[model samples]
Target: MSLGDEPGYGDAPRGEDGGYGGTGQTRTRLPDRAGDVYGGARRGRSSSRSLVTVVGVVVLLIAAIAFANRGDDESAPGTGDSDKTKTAPTAASGEQPVQSTAGGIPAGFAHTGQGAQSAAANYAVALGSAEMFNKSKRDAILTAVIIPSRVAEFESSLDKAYTPGFNKNVGLNEDGSTPQGYTFVSRTTPIGTKLTSSSADHATVEVWCSGLLGLAGDNSTNPVTNGWFTITMKLEWTSGDWKIVTHSQKDGPTPVPGDDRASSADDMAKAVEEYGGFTYAR
Candidate 1:
């Protein structure tokens, strides 16, 4: 469990980059059984591990409570149309303003209650995306989500972390490129969102998410990876829109999945390249 040397994530591609423990905050728990990353329910583990699980569950519950109370505030209750979309189909949530657009995607967002949650979820998706492994797309993402005051610092620091070799090792083409025949998928689905605090000027939202990270292909290294994480964001209602100010993440209370046929590298590669990504919401 050495730092940089730990395989996957930012390391060289593999035909199937076996799943590793989540990258955020690691919990204090008994190590998983052989080949099981989630630690199967074996009896007689240490109390510290049990305490970690309990804390994770409590944080999730708190986030749910916040989401339940958000729109009740009188300042920006949001219009019926937006509210309906936000709740009816999780897909309807997004902070995009009616006018501003970036790369033909929604750019600016209206400052409202729903907007904050939408911003949080979308930003979580972007921050955890495969694009974060590449310099250009990573820059675009930071510019799109981060508050202006912190953008430069954030970009510079992250630029250092996502080195060109690191990008290549993580399955990107040389020159921080995207290769043909492979679909890069690093996505997050927010189980829910909650507003920790808010005002007309700023808001903080937490999003609990499950994610996939991998490249699909026969000879591929770093074949898709998966994990559970929670993203907490501090946002500013800027120029009639919501922008992320600062953010942090922690690992999960993830459940164990049953054994299933692991797909071949070629099949994974084809599926990844052919499938399109979505704007996840909850």
Candidate 2:
């Protein structure tokens, strides 16, 4: 229980910048343990109170309220003339990319509309990262993306949510460590982002994300699976950057699953080891 010390729950593990390591770093080797902070893992999505976590009530509230306001269109965030609400091109928009990062999370976004969307998209990646299952790393990520005033509340809620039972359900040991001989994989890749509503200082964004979660190992009950979901983040421009005010997630505008060969546990483990997650952009 000391400040600036390792092995304590209260500590924010620092990087070379004295901040959390950015997600931009790729995995090159397996750690001694699969559950250490940084990357990889999946617990199948379940609804038991013990495993239902992240935003909880807030998530339900936002998912209910935001989509209600936007209408029930599964294909788009808003219902409008087909011409007006068409999906934007996915190529880079030529806007200024975030020039800096905090704890490996992209930061210093523009204060414009594009910036808010970028912030929400990138923030979604960080929030859904594998590191989230680790307490110290989770707190560091909350500090990096959440508005300063609400970090404690987020920490408190998620702390209760990522309980020992939850860990076990996710195929990890009670202490949240990946069991030996298995690779845990949890990752979120933002497919697209939509600006739901916006103003000069406050903005709401919807990020369509594809996620992978579950333990990847032969004979593993929790084999890695992919899911489609959308996360809505309420963001505010503050302290010269965009930070999340509140957010929630709901099952997706999921597409029809295509016929594709599944990878073996060994291959899945190797892919997770070699592939690197990107720092998302608009």
**What lDDT does each candidate get?**
0.70, 0.82
Using lDDT as the measure, the top candidate is 2
**What tens digits encode model 2's per-residue C-alpha lDDT throughout 1-282?**
012212333333456654455544443534446666423232222466335655587789998789656545554555454433344355456676598999999999998878998999899989988899999999999999999999999999999999999999989888889999999999999999888899999999999999999999979989899999999999998999999999999999898554356889999999999999876667
Q: Identify the runs in model 2 with alpha carbons over 4 angstroms from their true place.
A: 1-91
- lDDT tens digits by residue: candidate 1, 97-193: 2455554334555567667887787678778777787777888888888888889999999978777777777687766666887777777777878
Candidate 1 lDDT score relative to the true structure? 0.70
Q: For each candidate, what TM-score against the reference?
A: 0.61, 0.69
Per-candidate Cα RMSD to the true structure, in Å, reads 14.1, 22.5
Error of 2 at 216 (Å): 0.9
Candidate 1's error at 195, in angstroms? 1.3
Clash numbers, per candidate: 14, 9
